[model samples]
Target: MSSPRGGTARTAPPGRNPAPQPAPPPGPNPEPDSTGLVPYPAEVAARYRAAGLWRGHSLPAELMAAARAHGDRTALITPEVRWSYAELSATAERFAAGLLARTRLRPGDAVMFQMGNVAETVVTYLGCLLAGIRPVCTLPQHGTREVAVLARHLGARGLVLQADFGRGQLPEQARALLAEGVIEEAVVVRGEVFGKAVGYGELLRAGTGNDPGTLPYHSRPPEGVAVFQLSGGTTGLPKIAPRQHEEYAYNGALWGRTLGWGEGTVVLYPLPIMHNAGVSLALQPALLSGAALVLAPSADIGTLLDLIERTRPQVLPLVPPALAIRLLEEPRSHRTDLSCLTDFIVGGQKLPLEVAERLRDELGIAVRQKFGMAEGMFLLTPSGAGEWIRHHTVGTPLSPLDEIRILRPGTEDEVPDGEIGELCVRGPYTIRGYYRAERHNASAFTLDGFYRTGDLARRHRLGGAPCYSIDGRIKDVINRGVEKIHADEVEDLVMRHPDVAHVALVAMPDPVLGERACAYLVMEPGRAPLTVATLGAFLLGEGLARYKLPERVESVDALPLSNVGKVSKKELRQDIETKLAAETV
Candidate 1:
């Protein structure tokens, strides 16, 4: 599906309302501008420089500067507490010092983190940055098995974890792994018991002071690794992408400016900060722009609504599922004053047209679709609430330094606009290669060096500016709303089933979950009979996380084959859709 076109600024000369018409081609002046380049306001340019993001992907200097500039200003606000910039910086400094003292971690060491949308996640993140430690963020949804597998793959020197953020309980898992000689030490954030583990409270106490203002500072390269954002799990293995601090800073500041943010801008961060959208769109942008960063620790609709009411944030960057169902829940309307809201940027998955329409018509807020990745490239332009654009398009591309190209899925040839292909990106901020994954990295880039996004997209223009609309993923990944599952992993597990001959996992559209896995299996002849429930049980027994297990299974005598003799997952997905439709009817 494609999103609607963006609106353009028109000139009526003296004192007349310009007649509504099709927007002119993309440029600073659709009508006529001599410069030929869209000149950003001087203020926007100044803010970029002042925010310390004008360079490449560097953020430590800017983060330090912003925290110092807004020393007394509230940097982070949650239902439970608010942390001033000074307080956050100080806690981070102390936490950094404590980590340094307690572990062998040093500058450039990769530290794995799994925490929720709480204040500690931020503190620990900043702490890692300040200590010159690179952080690899993991989703809180991962169970012990996933964490163990990913952590082992990362070979992380340190781990920052909450006691029991979700089903995982990473700290306990880390401790158990340590006992099993899998890992060395684990750092606990909050209330989970672990012997010989460092508690976050104690780390906070080790900081500069209650004032946190007097802490010493050390400088690092702007191009240094700030955070290692993991690739979306919709693929086989999650790759760790090293985000530079400067580019990250620039992204945040630009996002702020795009929203007309300043000191008064209050942003609600419901998505976990570990995500690129969260860190770049919400926390980093708000901090850099001196806006209030409101925190919604839980995605619960009631809790989210309550926080929104109390905070009255101007921007809410959240995934679409939470907004859709909650906005339509009976009582249907919240009495809260959401008047301050200027934009509601939705990403992670495409926002359903019904949900967007209701949100715009009922909630009276602009529902802007954004396409972004942990790798730093993004698309954030205002889209018309038209059916074509809303349902078919994503939005226009952002980041002047970034270029997106659509290529034929199998071949490395560029494809015509509107034709679905593998999305490849080349940009100052986009990663050249994933950390330590040489073979995959080699395959991930073109010979000329554009990072292959592995996502299926169609190129388009919105009001003359280059934009893209996401159709589906070229990779074998499933987006289950909040969670992502690697199709290959599941297929591998399914192959282990004695009764299963072969299997393919594909995402089926779900109203609430965004997408759910539907497995099409070719059972071994004469093997113990296999059914949907039995396959699911076998998968669960194989230790696949609940969220990753197939929600529906279809037994097929043989998998549909493509012209190339490969199993046509597309046909399987279509079959699943047909079955689902038949059941619903």
Candidate 2:
């Protein structure tokens, strides 16, 4: 078959390895470019390539190869569409060609995505890869403030938005951004185009007559930046992490293989498809392994149950703790024929043992725990793990090359086994630094190159294998299901209110969401106490995402402080926990 770049595509004979390519000459790490992308150190890159961990193939080429191998197999399924491997590949190429033909966008340009879980999202994402455009995987819930911050940081060239999202306000927002020159172009999906915006369908039609084989696809090396993943915003604004084609692909392939996904495997994902987890865990893995991916438009329990009944997916890859709780609580879940499901992976927050046990006992399905970040380290409970390990621990690293260290918080000293400490890691897939964050990178990574995950964990030996259990987080961020709310970001926004003297956002224990932000405030002298509704309204007006708004508000005389003069969040957390326990009683 011809390559997307108008050349014959190379493939090895079946049952044989591909011929090795020559490596680049030894040298120092390349300087950061205008895009703020830092290349892996020369020796490190060579080591990964030599170990075959960093395969020298672009993402688009890998997708095309999968199509060639599984042409007739169903690859994508949504409420309104069902695309086979061949059709998905052809349509993606058409979209890629159309993007170049109909718009100013070109290969290597960065485009921000603000779409939902739908077939068009997959098509547009894959098309961007094929056209050599880098997608900034921003969530639909992101408001103008967040989007503007990310767009400005990455110098994003365009945006792909779901017009119907956010009560049809997304289109207006996109148009405003275009008018303001914040972004060069906007592509609307599932909505009418207006004022310098193009319809997605129109773009696809524009390339119908063009031959994809003759189009100039992305020519960058496999290690080149393929997409931008957003950090969980431990500090404040979400930082961008540039994911390369090789490591990102390796991430998905490794997870898919670890879970034993095959062509017949139907994987159902109900989360936001544009998020990093969605792409790495669901989209790439399923497509690369020739597995069928079922896209549930929403995470509503009823919707999820109905999709499971129809799709009969063997894997529900990235379920949050809240969704798992809702599924078990929903009456329809009992009636749904979930026997086809073999693996139900849970992550994004600590899964209560009760929830994991109930899912396993009531559903008779293997419940696997996962711990991952957009920065690239992934840990998952093996499929064959025992109930204790699966219920209590997040399991081992996905790659054998992954190097992990447990260090004392705020120091580089190693922590003994079974002792709680900060998790630090370096691996073939883990990123060395975030995009354009030079100052933050110094503290985010160790001098030796390990990325310091702000999570507290402890080493464990479960089922005769080394495992890790998440104890807590050292970062001041609240994990509310799949979305993380930066405490400082919210506190800063709340402090904007004239009546607020001081505010502290802390995670309150939640049975459903695992945790919800509760705002404790010391109001300005003589000011009326803030209500949850009033505070939420204030925050929403301040351009914070609805998910980040605090669910509860409390009046405090003063916030506890540590000996270092910092807000004693630990004491506040304990106070709130005690209150919640008393209320439950």
Candidate 3:
């Protein structure tokens, strides 16, 4: 945990900082709201869960059932093309048969697929299901380096990859890995074919006339792993989180119900389908509930908005940072025909309370915050709630088979209600441990059983509903020795300054003290008076602890953001460390 990427460990600001410590943690019994929905205890949550209407089944079975029910209905719609359920099912069946004919990839055999957001990606994923091949979905950024690491660790037999991803050539890198005996076979999708690398078209041809009915091989048990999603790779190398068939299917159904999606709903999946939110909110829900999925890459925001206008989707799932910044910069006139949008589901990153308010007040759209990770455990603010809670709270826990506990970080003791603690969860869908990393798993999980979410949250009642509010990340929180300052709180305070367009709070190296908060700011084009002292005064006036106040402020043209539109704190922290080192010299 000591500066993962080679930067000095951060510490509190140097000075006799006088700020009152946080109030004593609240006791278990909090007053309920007038509607009897707020401060809902475990008993009340149990009542809501007691309906016993949860859908727990195998993913393949659910896919087949949907295809049978809506044979000709449009299932997946891309900008360039449209695919009917029948057509997709047929194609997947053929592709699965082709995989079988080409390689000895049988049930339980892991195959790594490095793909982007495209139609072929979906087909490949479905094909894996039909063949009972465990598909490990990876980002386009992953080349031989990542693929080889994961392939060797997972004992992968095959690699399905896009020909060109960004600047990397899949054929060349894949060939290197193959030569090194990392991966046995390679199935290249998109563009030209190569020696030993079978093109998608050629492979599918072998499976032509394949019976769609016999597809989605059922040799593996329902509880067996179906998909392998990599962890955030925060602690040096990444770890694979395997998802089971039955629980994965159940997650989709539960998510569909939470979103209030039915057969007529059309979801816009602009992000990569490999992501949990993209799959759960858009693809899985659409497929399981017989709704239509609109696929588009999120790289081009304008194009995505255009697609939204054309498709008239009912639900739009978006990560907060990108859309929030867009809505702030772009005029209302640019948002075309969003009247069809019922709710804009935001997740993956911190959703500023200000952004939520603006969307609700200006666009007249509901901003529902959802919190989840790839390993599983989806907690959503129940859909169609009052505007206040939907905008602020991340909703209640949705999974019927899930259990949640907020324990003091570095300790097994559970914190009292209304107190921030590390969120730990265990459930049918949530992975018990990381794949092939006994050491990592031993560190990540509890003695009994629970995947530490690494997120700091507090139980809260908002708009008469019981839910958890994300304070910030344990890793990202600036530890000021005597007190811990959550970056989100600091960001929220600094964002209130009209001159500041966006802000990121990162820990900078300190001499005597361990670390001090360094503010990286993006200001309005003509805005001025952005200095270290000015920002420090603003935080002090806002009642932030002196240690919590930014000791240094670096004004920039714009904040560095990740591909997903979140302020890349990881990158920002690095930048600050570099600056600190240079200044020290």
Candidate 2 Cα misplacement greater than 4 A, ranges:
1-34, 234-238, 476-585
Sliding window of 10 residues with minimal summed lDDT for model 2: 1-10
Worst 10 residues of 3 by lDDT: 1-10
Best by TM-score: 3
**On residues 439-505, what C-alpha lDDT tens digit does candidate 2 reach at each position?**
7787887766777899888887543547888876777779899898868567768877879766778
lDDT winner: 2
Model 3: per-residue Cα lDDT at residue 382: 65
Instruction: Order the numbered candidates by TM-score, best leading.
Output: 3, 2, 1
Instruction: List TM-scores for all candidates, in order.
Output: 0.71, 0.78, 0.87
Q: What does the lDDT read for residue 270 in candidate 3? A: 69
Report RMSD for candidate 1: 13.2
lDDT of 1 by residue, 228-305 (tens): 777745245657676666666766776676666777677887666776667887888788778889888766667767
Candidate 2's C-alpha lDDT? Answer: 0.80
Residue 294's lDDT in candidate 3: 89
